[model samples]
Target: MNGKFIAIEGLEGAGKTNAIKQVGKILQEQGVHKIVFTREPGGTPLAEALRTLVKYGIDDEVITHEAELLMLYAARVQVLENVIKPAVTQGAWVVTDRYDLSSQAYQGGGRGIDSGLLNTLRDTILGNFYPDLTLYMDVAPSIGLKRVRSRTSGELDRIEVEPLAFFERIRSRYQILAEKDDRIITLDASQELSEVTSALRVQLIKWLKNKGY
Candidate 1:
């Protein structure tokens, strides 16, 4: 219960993975003894399997948008029950790559799913579980997609295969979410990677100090 759950969220090539790595290192240097690093859609074994199905377009014939949403929540349920909750109970700081917000943005905003349904699912399945702080890495959709595509050697996955318009919608949703939620902080990811990392570190330290951690 004493743990702080921090989530890094953005589009595909927003440098969240690198930021998480740097943040963890900084926290370790600061003597944060108990820290847990994990990610959504694949945090646990079950979730990892589901992640493959969801991201890789496996069983595409049977995978509807609603089904995708449900599958994501199912994986999240397992991660929350088995990994995240236990780590938090042990007073471990948790840093996650993505979480519920991804679902809302990708499924609801990009895919045109029902917001009411998403809200309902979130309330019933996730309940009061929410991140203590969320770092929303803001980047242009086209730039993010270009970065991703440049790094990929093979075919794109289902999410990555989405059009630029889809990513634009997702980016817009993220900005809206940040504006609506005080716990979410926005970082301009268009800057150099080092600058973004430094900004994130400063924000995290200030957040920790404010929370009396």
Candidate 2:
């Protein structure tokens, strides 16, 4: 049987780490042994470099939104071709922390980039490529940012330091996109960790069974 590509997406502090762990556990329980884990913009060596640039940026240099978006796609393409595609083709489930949806939410909505341009870029770059299942952990920007700030002692990354309005826009786009896509499942991430985990497990199991996993 062929493998599947699963992606988890949300704003920072949406508990993506927990969601990823839960997905792995559920997949194992469902008898999926060959799983390839990945995190967007850092799955490969080249992509890792780009991830650093995107996250921290260069010394004393202003990074434009257009450049940021391009760099993200560059990193995404590298991982998609080098890691994700090969793993799934070889019958290993590919689980990624983020995917194209991040671009749509962060770059398109948060940065207020033109939707036509974003759509054109996505279609031109990726064609029909997309995750088989996308799990979106939805949380309010204020709540999510508070959770993020509480955990990290170090300074926030470039994107992480964006205003609450930025994250709010991203969250809005995420909800809009998730609602439109059948393959994307939205989980309320404002709940306690245990509750989120329970919800994730239930949803994942149902999806897995539906897919005949």
Number of the top candidate by lDDT? 2
Off by over 4 Å in 2: none
TM-score of each: 0.96, 0.98
Which candidate comes out best when scored by TM-score?
2
Task: Kindly report which residue pairs in candidate 2 clash with one another.
Answer: none
Write the residue-wise lDDT of candidate 1 on 1-213 in tens digits.
577788889999999999899878888977886889999898988999999889886653757899889999999998988889889888998999999999999898898998999999999999999999999999999889999999999999888988899999999999999999999999999889989988998988888788786
Give per-residue CA lDDT, model 2, range 47-151, as digits (tens). 999999999999989999999999999999899999998899999999999999999999999999999988988898888999999999999999999999999
Clash totals, every prediction: 0, 0
Worst 10 residues of 2 by lDDT: 204-213
